[model samples]
Target: MADSNDSQPGAPVPCAACRGTGQVISNLGGSPSQVPCPWCEGSGTQIPGHDAQAARRAAAA
Candidate 1:
Protein backbone atom coordinates (compact mmCIF):
# COMPACT_ATOMS: atom_id res chain seq x y z
CA MET A 1 0.00 0.00 0.00
CA ALA A 2 1.24 3.49 -0.82
CA ASP A 3 1.11 6.55 1.38
CA SER A 4 -2.07 8.59 1.05
CA ASN A 5 -0.34 11.87 1.79
CA ASP A 6 2.12 12.00 -1.05
CA SER A 7 1.42 15.57 -2.15
CA GLN A 8 3.47 18.52 -1.01
CA PRO A 9 2.40 20.90 1.69
CA GLY A 10 -0.18 23.55 0.60
CA ALA A 11 -0.85 21.65 -2.57
CA PRO A 12 -4.30 20.46 -3.56
CA VAL A 13 -4.52 16.77 -2.98
CA PRO A 14 -6.31 14.20 -5.06
CA CYS A 15 -9.66 13.03 -3.82
CA ALA A 16 -9.46 9.94 -1.64
CA ALA A 17 -13.06 8.86 -2.17
CA CYS A 18 -12.47 8.55 -5.90
CA ARG A 19 -8.73 8.04 -5.80
CA GLY A 20 -8.43 11.03 -8.13
CA THR A 21 -10.54 9.36 -10.81
CA GLY A 22 -13.35 11.82 -10.21
CA GLN A 23 -15.77 8.93 -10.28
CA VAL A 24 -16.84 6.18 -7.94
CA ILE A 25 -18.42 2.77 -8.26
CA SER A 26 -21.57 1.87 -6.43
CA ASN A 27 -22.31 -1.81 -6.07
CA LEU A 28 -25.93 -2.78 -6.03
CA GLY A 29 -27.10 -6.36 -6.43
CA GLY A 30 -23.58 -7.18 -7.59
CA SER A 31 -23.82 -4.63 -10.34
CA PRO A 32 -21.39 -1.75 -10.37
CA SER A 33 -22.29 1.70 -11.64
CA GLN A 34 -20.04 4.71 -12.16
CA VAL A 35 -21.07 8.01 -10.69
CA PRO A 36 -19.37 11.37 -10.32
CA CYS A 37 -17.84 11.86 -6.90
CA PRO A 38 -19.68 14.24 -4.59
CA TRP A 39 -16.30 15.56 -3.63
CA CYS A 40 -14.12 17.26 -6.28
CA GLU A 41 -16.97 17.26 -8.81
CA GLY A 42 -15.16 15.31 -11.50
CA SER A 43 -12.06 17.52 -11.21
CA GLY A 44 -10.52 15.11 -8.65
CA THR A 45 -8.71 17.67 -6.48
CA GLN A 46 -9.43 18.52 -2.85
CA ILE A 47 -8.13 20.72 -0.07
CA PRO A 48 -6.46 18.66 2.64
CA GLY A 49 -9.23 18.83 5.25
CA HIS A 50 -11.85 20.78 3.38
CA ASP A 51 -15.26 19.71 2.14
CA ALA A 52 -17.43 21.63 -0.29
CA GLN A 53 -19.39 23.40 2.41
CA ALA A 54 -16.29 24.30 4.35
CA ALA A 55 -14.56 25.54 1.24
CA ARG A 56 -17.53 27.73 0.48
CA ARG A 57 -17.57 29.10 4.01
CA ALA A 58 -13.89 29.79 3.93
CA ALA A 59 -14.23 31.57 0.64
CA ALA A 60 -17.07 33.66 2.00
CA ALA A 61 -15.23 34.68 5.12
Candidate 2:
Protein backbone atom coordinates (compact mmCIF):
# COMPACT_ATOMS: atom_id res chain seq x y z
CA MET A 1 0.00 0.00 0.00
CA ALA A 2 1.19 3.47 -0.81
CA ASP A 3 0.62 6.35 1.56
CA SER A 4 -0.87 9.56 0.17
CA ASN A 5 1.61 11.51 2.25
CA ASP A 6 4.44 9.96 0.28
CA SER A 7 5.75 12.13 -2.49
CA GLN A 8 7.23 11.03 -5.78
CA PRO A 9 10.94 10.49 -5.71
CA GLY A 10 12.91 13.73 -6.33
CA ALA A 11 9.79 15.87 -6.03
CA PRO A 12 10.17 18.97 -3.98
CA VAL A 13 8.16 18.86 -0.78
CA PRO A 14 7.10 21.94 1.09
CA CYS A 15 9.40 22.55 4.02
CA ALA A 16 8.04 21.50 7.38
CA ALA A 17 9.81 24.36 9.10
CA CYS A 18 8.58 27.17 6.84
CA ARG A 19 5.35 25.59 5.62
CA GLY A 20 6.51 26.43 2.05
CA THR A 21 6.92 30.11 2.80
CA GLY A 22 10.72 29.79 2.91
CA GLN A 23 10.70 31.91 6.03
CA VAL A 24 10.17 31.60 9.75
CA ILE A 25 9.23 34.04 12.48
CA SER A 26 11.85 34.81 15.03
CA ASN A 27 10.70 36.41 18.25
CA LEU A 28 14.12 37.42 19.40
CA GLY A 29 14.33 40.34 21.84
CA GLY A 30 10.52 40.36 22.02
CA SER A 31 10.14 41.40 18.39
CA PRO A 32 8.76 39.19 15.68
CA SER A 33 10.92 39.17 12.59
CA GLN A 34 10.97 37.11 9.45
CA VAL A 35 14.05 35.05 8.77
CA PRO A 36 14.98 32.51 6.16
CA CYS A 37 14.00 29.00 7.25
CA PRO A 38 16.99 27.15 8.56
CA TRP A 39 15.55 23.76 7.71
CA CYS A 40 15.06 24.54 4.04
CA GLU A 41 17.78 27.15 3.86
CA GLY A 42 15.14 29.52 2.40
CA SER A 43 14.33 27.13 -0.43
CA GLY A 44 10.91 26.23 1.02
CA THR A 45 11.56 22.57 0.30
CA GLN A 46 12.40 19.72 2.61
CA ILE A 47 15.88 18.32 2.47
CA PRO A 48 16.39 14.63 3.06
CA GLY A 49 17.59 13.93 6.62
CA HIS A 50 16.98 17.53 7.63
CA ASP A 51 15.67 17.79 11.16
CA ALA A 52 12.68 20.13 11.40
CA GLN A 53 12.68 20.25 15.19
CA ALA A 54 16.32 21.26 15.33
CA ALA A 55 15.72 23.97 12.79
CA ARG A 56 12.73 25.21 14.76
CA ARG A 57 14.84 25.41 17.90
CA ALA A 58 17.58 27.28 16.05
CA ALA A 59 15.07 29.68 14.55
CA ALA A 60 13.60 30.36 17.99
CA ALA A 61 16.99 31.02 19.46
Candidate 3:
Protein backbone atom coordinates (compact mmCIF):
# COMPACT_ATOMS: atom_id res chain seq x y z
CA MET A 1 0.00 0.00 0.00
CA ALA A 2 1.04 3.56 -0.62
CA ASP A 3 1.55 6.09 2.12
CA SER A 4 -1.61 7.90 3.11
CA ASN A 5 0.12 11.07 4.17
CA ASP A 6 1.20 11.91 0.67
CA SER A 7 -1.04 11.75 -2.34
CA GLN A 8 1.92 11.79 -4.70
CA PRO A 9 5.32 10.85 -3.48
CA GLY A 10 8.24 13.03 -4.55
CA ALA A 11 5.85 15.66 -5.82
CA PRO A 12 5.65 18.51 -3.38
CA VAL A 13 2.84 21.02 -3.41
CA PRO A 14 3.44 24.48 -4.77
CA CYS A 15 4.75 27.17 -2.46
CA ALA A 16 2.10 29.37 -1.01
CA ALA A 17 4.25 32.49 -0.98
CA CYS A 18 5.20 32.38 -4.67
CA ARG A 19 2.15 30.52 -5.92
CA GLY A 20 4.51 28.09 -7.67
CA THR A 21 6.09 30.91 -9.66
CA GLY A 22 9.29 30.69 -7.59
CA GLN A 23 9.19 34.47 -7.24
CA VAL A 24 7.27 37.10 -5.33
CA ILE A 25 6.80 40.85 -5.42
CA SER A 26 9.01 42.95 -3.24
CA ASN A 27 7.75 46.40 -2.30
CA LEU A 28 10.90 47.68 -0.75
CA GLY A 29 11.37 51.47 -0.62
CA GLY A 30 7.82 51.86 -2.02
CA SER A 31 8.90 50.27 -5.26
CA PRO A 32 7.55 46.98 -6.55
CA SER A 33 10.06 44.39 -7.70
CA GLN A 34 10.20 40.67 -8.30
CA VAL A 35 12.30 38.57 -6.00
CA PRO A 36 12.75 34.92 -5.17
CA CYS A 37 10.30 33.76 -2.56
CA PRO A 38 11.92 33.52 0.84
CA TRP A 39 9.54 30.93 2.14
CA CYS A 40 10.37 28.25 -0.43
CA GLU A 41 13.81 29.64 -1.11
CA GLY A 42 12.80 30.03 -4.78
CA SER A 43 12.10 26.31 -5.31
CA GLY A 44 8.38 26.96 -5.81
CA THR A 45 7.34 24.20 -3.44
CA GLN A 46 6.03 24.02 0.09
CA ILE A 47 8.87 23.50 2.54
CA PRO A 48 8.84 22.00 5.98
CA GLY A 49 7.58 24.26 8.82
CA HIS A 50 5.68 26.41 6.33
CA ASP A 51 2.32 27.52 7.63
CA ALA A 52 -0.06 26.77 4.79
CA GLN A 53 -3.14 28.29 6.46
CA ALA A 54 -1.38 31.56 7.23
CA ALA A 55 0.13 31.69 3.78
CA ARG A 56 -3.25 31.20 2.17
CA ARG A 57 -4.71 33.98 4.29
CA ALA A 58 -1.86 36.30 3.39
CA ALA A 59 -2.24 35.48 -0.26
CA ALA A 60 -5.94 36.25 -0.03
CA ALA A 61 -5.07 39.69 1.30
**Which one wins on lDDT?**
2
- CA RMSD of all predictions: 8.6, 5.4, 7.2
Residue-wise C-alpha lDDT for candidate 2, range 1-61, written one tens digit per residue: 7687776778888998789999999897899999888889899988889876886687579
Better of 1 and 3 by TM-score: 3
Worst-scoring 10-residue span by lDDT in model 1: 47-56
lDDT per residue, candidate 1, 1-61, as tens digits?
Answer: 8787686677877898899998978685699999776577777886455576765466569
Output the lDDT of residue 54, model 2: 89
Q: What lDDT is obtained when candidate 3 is compared to the true structure?
A: 0.82
Where does candidate 1 stray beyond 4 Å? Answer: 1-9, 28-30, 47-61
At residue 42, give the lDDT of candidate 1. Answer: 74
Q: Model-by-model lDDT, in order?
A: 0.74, 0.86, 0.82
Of 1 and 2, the candidate ranking higher by lDDT: 2
Order of models, best TM-score first: 2, 3, 1
Give the least accurate 10-residue stretch of model 3, judged by summed lDDT: 50-59
- Across 4-60, the per-residue lDDT of candidate 3 in tens digits comes to 776766769898779999999989779999987878878898898866568557776
Question: TM-scores, in order shown?
Answer: 0.52, 0.67, 0.63
